[model samples]
Target chain A: MLTEKRNWGWHVLLILIVMAIMLPVLFMISNSFKTLQESYHAILQLIPAKPTFSNYLTLNKQINLLRMVSNTFLMAMIVTLGKVATGLLAAYAFQNFHFKGKRLVYFIFVATIFVPFTTVMIPNYLVIAKMNLLNNVIGVALPQMADATGIMLFIKAMGKIPASLTESAKVDGIPNRKIFMNLIIPLLKPSIISVGAIFFINSWNEYVWPTLVLKDKSSFTLPLALQNYISSEGGTNFPLAMALAVIMIVPPLLIYMIFQRYILNSISTSGLK
Target chain B: MLNNNSQIEEAVNSRYGPRASRKPRRRLLPFLYLLPSALLLLVFMIIPIGYTFYLSFFNWNLIAPTKEFVGLANYVNVFTDPTNQKVILNTLVYIVLLVILNFILPYFISLIVNFFIGKMKGPYKILFFIPSLFSLVVGAMLFSWILNPVSGPLALFLRDFGMKVPQWTNSGAMAIVVICLITNWKVFGYNFILLLTGLGAVPKNILDAAALDGVPKWRVIWNIVLPLNRGVAIYVFILTIVQGLQYVFTPINVITQGGPYYGSSNLLYHTYLNAFVLYKTGNASALATVTFVIFLILLFIEIKFVEGRHKDAD
Candidate 1:
């Protein structure tokens, strides 16, 4: 059809446009390797001339980057586990049960997705503080335990498991819990992993709630730690900030890369569905 | 009442049903599973919303031993205060700019990439989506440095031609614009993917059929593509305005903190400032309640719109 030759025009223009769109991210990676002097003076360079690892050292010294990374990882893990567990149980109930007031209960859980965090930020902070969870990772993770999105995603996932499989298991006198554990759980592995990735990334990038609770630098998540570099005084140290930025982006980026297809596909399909 | 109902049910089960004896416990199992998520939803979400309302009626500095009930005075303050007036206006501006940058921009970009381009949409999508995964804190820092008027890369490039970069962070309106730009960069690709995938659902032969009849490309898109993809379009439109409020918060915090005399502050950030920094608990709650009402109204509007579109299609 000669479509390949005609497509050359489209490819050339898109390549240039995408490069412009991607320049900031490219700069973010490149500038992390530069000295403070070159970062300021050689501003447009896509690659650093004299690269150094000193920025990483300074980042560690200034804020103990490793500690923040661990704190964030722990917090996200707890939150993701909590969401997935609750979501699985709830989704199983919704999928299998014909309980009274099920519609009301489903709406109650699913509707929270529409409730903006800002409207409830103050009360959530007060509640966390009252639990004596100030300056704690658990404080950041607790209120986020039951996510409605995970419930919605899981319900859609469970709908795909053929009903006859569960029905025959029930006929054999198998309890619902065992059926869930053995049959549904293994079948729902892909959904769990993709949903887990979404929850983990959301929790990892969470800044507002963590900023409210984790005031101590030692307890801060990576996004909150960047706040130290963002204030007027800390903005002067460009290279270290870039280094910290690079460090802060890596875990979520890695998760995203590894789970990219499943993640994007499920998000789009679930939203449209 | 509970004892009477169960006693009656036990009598019925004894009389008629050995299998029915297990029905009560079976009904109870689902509730037991539903309890944990429901309890969390109550504590973290439902109860907090109610608490926000209760606090809105009382004046508290959060340091004091007692809260004095003022009853609607805090709501009055949110409405009467000049700073809050500016913040409410700023919130409206944010909705507009966010819709433009996040929704409309991605709409056109998705159209171009899907209709005009031929191959390897996946790779381009991945490149754009790569930014969406990172923290907006990173985006805030990235844009602040790149658009820095003086030593930033953009400034340095423009200076070679004796051009000067605009000092965006210098003013309140410009600060808000810059914040919107930063979020657009972070959010654009995801929305692009959504719309493109939605567009991909339109039958290719319909477009080709229209084209063979000498119909313009825009006609085919408007008549065929847009009608089919309205679901994703509406989802993205509301999402842009709703989630956009929160997305702009990080940039506002990292860049402006609602500074230059509450110039760039929107309703959400203003509420945060009132609660935490100023410690005006009642005032913040009032603002929070107002923001909630606004969001509810937006949801109501969307429901209405979706129904109306459904009727027209029918």
Candidate 2:
């Protein structure tokens, strides 16, 4: 009897915990279906009595929703591709090649992680302005192109690649560049894919830097666009804003699901190790 | 094993006309690989830190561009001012509460989830992890409604029970605490996922051995699982500390706007306000330096502890 009660208690707590975790998301989805009048009503209703697509339709027409989605997608892809290419190259060098200042350079790069974005935001803005890159997708992509996290992941992934393969390639008169291109890159495919997914998601969701740099409405990323919409036009229109939220969330969610197998593998390995 | 010069020399001679011709190339490849990141660090990362230090020493303002060096003036003002001190204290309290909740809540959630792992874990993990995938603006906005004093779910429940629903965001102190709760709630799934991975890394044989020795399941968790997953604990703590500092900006900006009065103002948002809004670049730089130093010390301590324990275990 006592054991049964304990089991029941555990199951109840687990369900409650899961509910607590999911309640907000469920509420947001439900609210998206709610009418403005219904949402603003004093009573909280789990189910919307009058479901409508007006909020969603308004979201599509009023906000440049598709443009923001494409803009975010393009920028994230550019940044992800740049990081993978550069990160893989650097990691291959560190793993297979030995030279002076290797440890020092690696340490310097790792140390970059400590310097918070706020410290660099002012100067980064200045640098971007000097390059005439402000209000451009390239501006958003440049700083993220060589992230330390990708480099670290690549280095760790490449380290796990056996040295025998590189030695064998060298014995066959393979050039250093060729070895990196043909051998190291292939071996690090999983790492590249995983890091690319993470980088893409991060870039897609990035807000502050874009908020600071991009002043053009046409060039606005999804998060920035949604934020602007919420603060300005969508204020007090919780249903419409929730619809916008749903729209902003869908692409990343789709991308996440597509690459979920790699993501889970990478996350489990990266987190545990 | 070419852990020495001979293999490199042989490769050098084979690659180029001679060993002498190859020397510079060998010396150059590593630097060449690092050049882009190093230059980026110099221009964007390192110089910015130096510029922050320089700005802190001057009476720099965005509005008034007459930069005058004030030596230790901003630093002195930041340290000596009561309001600045309160912000620092509040930031520390916020971080401590965040670290505690982020570390503990997720650990148990992972523990509970591990009980029913095989069939439903994938969907369960995704369900739990989805909240973290939302942007801070959305999360904060959603929670703001959830915590609304009048018509929110909580308030409505209280109203039916004939109890007054306290306005959480109206008061400064409670506002900060509620922000921390919301922050923790949003992030708990991420840590839970991480902890589950750590728990999965524990060898099954060790648990089996403990069970055969008649050790209770609780003891097995305490003695075997917890000790082995120390790395996850360290990682979680370090990440929580850094994220905790960075995230104070979101709550400060969105929920309170740094207060009913500057009550919930943590260091980062305060620095931002000083830099852009109020145009006290000097004060902002000084504040950034102090916060950076505090973070560096904490990171150093965490590294030392982890390394010491690791070495002892090995």
Candidate 3:
């Protein structure tokens, strides 16, 4: 009887914590549907008294929300593809082949994770400027494409494949490239999916670098666009800013919902290994 | 069949001069496979890091035609500046708070959820992790809206409860605390899930045995569950440090711009302010170098301590 009572108490506590965690997200979505007056005055209400689409409509008129979303999508896709390709090639080399300085090279690549991007932000900006890629989405995406975490995760996944599978193919006179493409690539579907999703979400959500590189309004990614909107116009336009925030969040949230299992798996597997 | 195959392989190898003919081409193949990533990393990561180090010794505005070398003056300036000192203190506080909230709190939360919430674990996890799904800028914006004095739900709730909600942004220490709170809210679920995975690996039989031996639940957790998952704990620690720098960047930029008086700014934000806002490339590079060295030491410790134990266990 005492244990049952204690269990119920724990349940109540957990539910309360969950509500606190969900509160901001719920508030943002709720306010996005409110009118300016309702948002300002009905702040304590969970649901808007009179829900309206005016905030979103106003946002559409003031800024190119569609363009910003598309820009983010394009940059994310390109960067994800680049990182996956580079990660796969490097992982295959590290796992399948034996070469001098292999250990040193792998160590160096892994060590890059420790060097936070902020440390090299200035120099990278200079390089991008020199190449005349400033204000270009390509410049915003290029520096971030070389990801150490993606490569390391791919290496870990590749290590799990049995050596005999590759060796038997080699003995049958299959070319290395063919083996990698026809045999190994198919086996690595799960890792590819998880890693690609991570890359996509990360690139989609990237802010500081894009903010630094892209100055043109047309070139603004979603996060940058949202930041500009909020800082300049968000004071009086709370509902509209909330709407932009909702738009900015939807893609990543969708991806997260769909791939939560893979993401969690990837984190644990990479960390524990 | 095995003997015949071995004889055939020996004959082929002998004809090819003990594998040398095939080995030379294959030796280059690995490098070919590695070249793309290596070149990109060299250009983007390795070379830039070296250049950042080089730039730290000179004084230059990025647009200037000439950069004058000043040796360690930039480093001295970083150390002596009062504003920079506050930034350093903010960063240290952020890291310490993150270790408590992000690492320690999540570990315990995972344990409770795993232990008590039997069937609701999946749904609870998804709910908790929802905040992290949003982009950092979006998350910060949402919090800023919620913390707005006039229109924020938080203020309204506090007012209803007859409590005063302070002006979070205008206050220096409170601003940093609020940013940390927002960060922890967004991130704790991620670490919780990671810790749950770690906890799942703890042997059930041992727990049962401990229970059978009359070991208290707290004792079982403190002695067995924690020690068994030290690897994950250490990983969580290192991640907190690394991410502490990155995570606060967005919030500070969006919400506070590093201050009512530079109280919320950390090393990363300071680097940005120096480089972009002030156009002091050299000073920014010097600060970056210092931050880089500090993390390098932390990373080295992680490798030596945590990863070393991991390998031994494997």
After best superposition, candidate 1 residue B55: deviation in angstroms?
A: 1.3
lDDT per residue as tens, model 1, B1-314: 54685586668778878486668779798987788888888888998889998899999986788999998999998889999999999999999999998999888878878887677788888887877888999888988887778778788888989998887766899899999998998898888888888788777898888888988777888888898888778878887888899889999999889867888899999999988999999999999999988888777766666666667556
lDDT of each residue in A1-273, candidate 1, tens digit only? 334566678777767757866887778888889998888888778888988888888787777777889999999999999999998988999999998999988877877777778677877887888899989888989887846888899999998889999999999977677798889999999889989998898888888888899988789899988767875422456677778888878888898889998888777776455
Write one digit per residue (lDDT tens) for candidate 2, span A133-226: 9999988777766467777888878878888888998888666776877788887787788778878877887776777678899889877766
Candidate 3: tens digits of C-alpha lDDT, residues A128-185 = 9999999888899899986678879988888889999999999997767778888888
Q: What is each candidate's DockQ, to 2 decimals? A: 0.58, 0.45, 0.61
Q: How large is the interface RMSD of each prediction?
A: 2.0, 3.0, 1.9
Name the 10 consecutive residues with the lowest summed lDDT in model 2 chain B.
B112-121
Instruction: Judging by TM-score against the true structure, name the best candidate.
Output: 3
State candidate 1's TM-score. Answer: 0.93
- For model 1, the superposed segments whose C-alpha errors exceed 4 Å read A1-13, A233-235, B1-21, B305-314
TM-score of each predicted structure versus truth: 0.93, 0.90, 0.93
**Which number leads on DockQ?**
3
Runs off by more than 4 Å, candidate 3: A1-5, A232-236, B1-21, B311-314
